[model samples]
Target chain A: MKRKKLRRAEDLFFTWVMRACLMTAAVVLGLILFVIFWRGIGALSWEMVSQPPSGGFYLSQGGGGVFHAIVGSLYLAAGATLLASLIAVPVVLYIHVYSPNGRLANNLRLALDIMWGIPSIVYGAFGFALMIYLGMRASLLAGIITLALVVLPILARTFDEVVSMAPRHLHETTFSLGSTRLEFLGVLLRQTVPGLLTAVLLAFGRGIGDAASVLFTAGFTNNMPEGLLRPVASLPLAVFFQLGTPFPEVQARAYASALILTVIILTISILAQLSISRLGRHVIR
Target chain B: MEATPDTTIRPLPAKKIAASRLSRWRWFKDAGARTMLGATAVIICLLIVVITAALTARSWPILSAYPLAELLTGQVWQPMRGLFGFAPFIAGSVAVTLVAMAFAVVPAVFSGMYLAEYTSSRTRSALKPLIDLLVGIPSVVYGLWGVLFIVPLVRDHIGPLSDRTLGQFFPFFARTNPSGYGLLAAGFVLAVMVFPLIVAVTEEVLRSIPREMRETLLALGATRWETTRCIMRRAALSGTLAAIVLGFSRAFGETLAVMMLIGNTPRIPSSLFDAAYSLPALIANNYGEIMSVPLYESALMGAALLLLIVVLGFNVMARLVIMRLTKRS
Candidate 1:
């Protein structure tokens, strides 16, 4: 009877401890957001988001903005998401449609998982090496290719997960109609469109937020975004560069850029959540 | 009554495509898709080999110039004088990753248990979006938060408090540096980034535990805590380890955030408060700058290659352990 009481007491104690742990995590997240917002809100303004940096902007000479960075980040992340999708879709489709149970598919998933584990800086180094070999300069194209590599495995795996979640009857319906493997894939793809969109958004969020992979490949520029072959400023790198300066105003700009980035990510996540709900409605499980 | 009308030369069901009616164009598309998709899969599978090979071939110049052992173990890191030692960075990487894992694992495991065993499905669904937001926040922003909040908190509270108290128990707790930008701060920042990640994986692993296992424990009159302890230690051990390993791989290769808060001094640090350098930091800070020295770029590339190898090695080890565990059970 005593031992039973002791066990009961221990159970009650640990339950509270676990709940406290969950609360602690949530509180930390809240504090982080609060800090960013507190420091960054002062720097937020219409002109700040509307214009690119003017002459002597880092020197705090004139009106400055991160419009270029906002644009550049969108362009680079979209291009990367597109490039990654081009490769990821075909691979995921082949795995699910052609050989879902084959050894090759298993190996392919493992490879992608490993690739996903690699750091962004290594991708930058590899991109730099490839650029040198190709006799190319730090251009948007180079950054796209490098960032694509960083985003590829993530896109592929998320796509695979979404595709896997597709109702099993999708296979029965598609194949039962005397469809070829590719035709069945088309039907399945149509069903998981919402999940696929969510996956793309997730990958885009990852690609846009990473600064290391594009540090060298996508050369930074203060001017507005130009052609594909030219340098483009990115939001994360903008935050990094502004913070590197000694001037207080420039550092404040860094805070502002971080705020913008945080907001963008929050929006993407909200969209992803909406799409996830829509996914259930789209398919009859 | 409609049997005669059924023979009115009805066309094939629009959706049900039969092989006999497959047009020449449709045939080409089918064949093309197979060839394209199969080839893409093959290339994607070979990507790991391609990345490893590229990094190695690029960094071989430095490895060939100096003995591998010396490059890895030597202390000094003067790039201008042709000295290329990575000992400090490696040690720093290990220390920071250790600190991050230490701070992250407990909270993550507890949260995972709560979500897996306690929460209703409604609560779980509502909480997922919050977790997703946490996971999606960029590391740079986390670094920004660290600079603004954690660094100052350490400078004001943790640094002095630990010095007065923890220093009595152990000398290492007494820090020489008070700027609050050091291993502990970096670890804290990194922990925030990885907490949600570990939680996600842990929840997956714990939920994957068979219902029968839980029922059996309860049927044996075991309390909730007792059952949980047994299950976590035995049944969920491998998955939890894999989760931690995955978290470590993430913390190991993280660059920008650690660089911002680690105070970027290239040396082995004795105290947790001392500034230290990391491998990813080494690559990120020096990769694009002047390459006047002959083997400077090579040395940086070597750091990148080493980072790649370490993270991938851990991932592969975890994969093997998981494969073995799943096979056995």
Candidate 2:
């Protein structure tokens, strides 16, 4: 009886500890979401959403909405994702279907893995130097191109995994049918569409969340992006630049902005997860 | 095996057409495929080379202009007057990372241990998404929280508590600021940021330990904690350290949140409350406005190279540790 009581006490201790840790994580997440929403809801007026931030950040008055930032972020992220996807798909397909030896493939994979270790700030510095040399001067083209470079390795690595999952029989069957290179590519592309979409969305999520890489390359301009070479503001940069000021209202607005950005990313990540599972179901079926 | 005279696809000579279509397309067997694959490998390798070259080119100008002694030992960072000492940035990065790791490692390991060894599948499944959500939130958002909430709360609450505790033990803790968004606060937030990575990797490593080992240990009447602490943890030590190092790398490279929270003053932090500068932040804030051309740019790249070296060093060390562990095990 005494031993049983001791065992029960120990179990109780363990359970409570686990519960406390989970609860702490939940609380931190909740607190961030709550503060963002609570402060941001009032700041998220239609005008704020529609107009651009003016010369100065004003919470209640003239500095307008996040329209340019929203549009710029979407355009740049979309452009980067599209470019990265296009480049990665072909390379990944070549690696998956045509590569003869494993040694070269292993080296490529390690190179991509090491790319992840390089800091975003370093990427920004590189991009900044290149942009100045190319005379892009903090334009949209500079920003989008830099973003594309930053996300290229990530997209390639993810797509390589997704493409490698294509069944060997599919390739052999296509070969047996004497499909041309283009025809084989079409077939492989059709099969990997869902996985590729997931990879793109994941890339998009990453692009959206990135800030430091964009700051030096994509100079913040209040005006909406007009051409491929115009300056633009992104959500991360907007939040980052605004958070350090003395204005409480501007600070609160930053919170709301962050919340919105996180929600968008969270939605994309969930969608990617869902698509992968959906792809699994299709495979099983 | 001569080609047919009426071959429709291409008007080739009989000898050229003698090769089967399969052999023609067999790039893997043919030199063409080998060349293409080899070229692809070269392209990937070139990207690494280009990035390294870019970093080197960027740093070269600055390093040439500034002597090594001044860059390494100098404290003041006046870009206008052409004086840039990166020692304080290095110190700040080390300070924040160490404090963050301290805050994050203990709880992260314990929680990871419990999740892996103690929790039921249902709980694990339900709790995992929540943890993932924490991980997915962007670092800038963390900075926002640090600024608006954490700073105030720490200033109003934590500082007093620290003051009272340190009042008995140390004089340094007495002159604390309420702004919790200093080195300690940034570290705390970073700990949260890296918690999921450590927990996930550590849990994965722990779970890979054979179930029978746990059962065998338990069959000897050891308590769950005893089994976990002694057998599972010991076995998974390499993985745990790797996870921690991975967390360290992530924290080290993290820029936006750390930049926003760590008050961007270029002073050596005597106390946690004093504003600090990190390498990434220093580059981010000044890279755009660098006036001395190569000198400032090189300093920034050198800082990046420094940060890169730290992360890569950790990665290499972790790999070595895991290799050693595997050999011994």
Candidate 3:
């Protein structure tokens, strides 16, 4: 009887601990989101998003904004998403069509999984090495290439999963229609278009928010992105640099930048949701 | 030409000629798609090899010049004088990663269990998105939160509290840092960053387990916790381990949040409060100086290579384990 009672007590204790862990996670998320909003909302303003940083803005002479960083992040992520999708789509389609479960296909999947696991900082280092070998500088073009490397695995893997989840019957139907393999590919893609969009947005969000990979490759500048070959500022790096300043106001601006970034991500998630739900109708499902 | 008796070779009709031309074009297009798309797949596969090669080529100079053991174990990190010992960075990275994993794994597992077993489908669905939000938050923003909140908590509370109590028992808690930016802060920030990943994967794993196991255990008069500890946990062991490994790899490679709070001192930390340098942080911080020094770039690249190899090793192991678990399920 005593042993049974002790077991019950132990179980009760374990249950409570589990509950506590759940509460802790919820509280932590709440705290983080709360802190960001509370500190950030005050510093956010139209001017903050409209103009580039003035001279000595780091010193809190700040009549300027992180406009360049915002725009540059968009430009960088947009270009990278385009490049990654161009490559990822073709590769994913090929994997699905040609050799769905062959050694090459399996290895390719593993390769992408490994790539997805690589730290952005290592990607940054690798990109820097490649840039040096190519005699390239830390310009927008270089940053785009590096960021593409970072997001490619993500795009490819997510799209691959989407493509794989596609009902096999679609393939049969396409073949039964006496369509060529390319036409079958077209039909498969049409069915998974929403998923592909979701994958692209996911990659774009990841690319835009990443800091380590772009820290060296995307050299910062106060100017607006003048050309693809010129150095460009990014939101993550902007927040990092701004917070590094000794001035409180400059640091506050960092919070504002964080808020902007968070808002952008939130928007992307919203779009992903909308895309999946509203776009599900046309999908073969 | 002979199939249709009436349509025997009557000067090769125009329709037949056009049909043959179109079929040839279609065949060419099919082959073109096959080869081109196949090449893309091959290129994607070669990407990892290329990354490894590029990193090795870049870091070869430092590796060839310095003895391997000395470079890895040497303590001093004076790059100006060409002393690029990676001992401190390695220790710092390992320590911080360990700390992060320790803090993260239990809570993550317990929460994952709760979500997977106890919660209704409705609650699970509602909370899963919230957990994903944690994963989606940018590391730099996490860094910002650490700087504003966690660093100060460490400086004022955790630092002094540990120094008074646990400090007496363990040297690891003995030091009281004034700046409050150290391994502990970095680990805490990274813990928050990796928490969601572990939870998501663990929950996924647990959910994939056969529901019959739980029903049988409960029907045998087992409490929910008993069922969880014995049957559910046992079944989900490999998956949970994979989750932990995945989380560990994620924490190990985290750069931005850690960089913000680790104080960037180039020495191995003996205590949680002592400032430390990490390999990723080293690469991130030393970008500007790489151009000035001769082997500085190579040294940093070497650090990157070390980090990459470690993360890659963990990921491959985790992948294999996950594959095993999935196969069993």
**Per-model DockQ against the true two-chain complex:** 0.56, 0.44, 0.53
Which is the better candidate, 2 or 3, if ranked by TM-score? 3
Candidate 2 on B1-329: residue-level lDDT in tens? Answer: 98779522312332343368764554333345446646866687577568667777777777777787888889988766778888899888888888789888877877788789888998887788777677777778887777777777777887788777874587545534455657877878888888887887678678767778899889998778668877645688877888799788878888988887887778777666656888888888886667655367667778877777687677656645544444343
lDDT score, candidate 2, position A228: 82
Task: Give the alpha carbon lDDT tens digit for every residue of A162-198 in model 3.
Answer: 9999997787767666666666778878889999998
- Sequence-dependent TM-score of model 2: 0.86
Provide interface RMSD per model, one decimal.
4.1, 5.7, 6.0
Q: Is candidate 1 or candidate 3 better by TM-score?
A: 1
Which has the better DockQ: candidate 2, or candidate 3? 3
Fraction of native Cα contacts reproduced by each candidate: 0.76, 0.38, 0.70
- Candidate 3's C-alpha runs over 4 A off are A1-16, B1-21, B211-221, B231-233
lDDT of 3 at B277: 89
Across residues B1-329, which tens digit of lDDT does each residue of candidate 3 receive? 55755421111222333377775576567669989988888888898889988998999999999999999999999989999899999999999998899899999999999888889988887787678678778999999999989999999988989999999999999865689999999999899889998897788788778888899998998888999987545788888898899898888888999999998998889998989988899889889978798999899989998888899899988877776666566
In model 2, pairs of residues that clash are A48-A65, A51-A65, B59-B298, B61-B294, B62-B294, B62-B295, B155-B178
Clashes counted in candidate 2 amount to 7
lDDT accuracy of residue B180 in candidate 1: 96
Question: What is the lDDT ranking, best to worst?
Answer: 3, 1, 2
Candidate ranking under DockQ, highest first, comes to 1, 3, 2
Deviation in angstroms for A255 in model 3? 1.5
For candidate 1, lDDT tens digit of each residue in B57-116?
988999999999999999999988989999999999999998999899998888888888
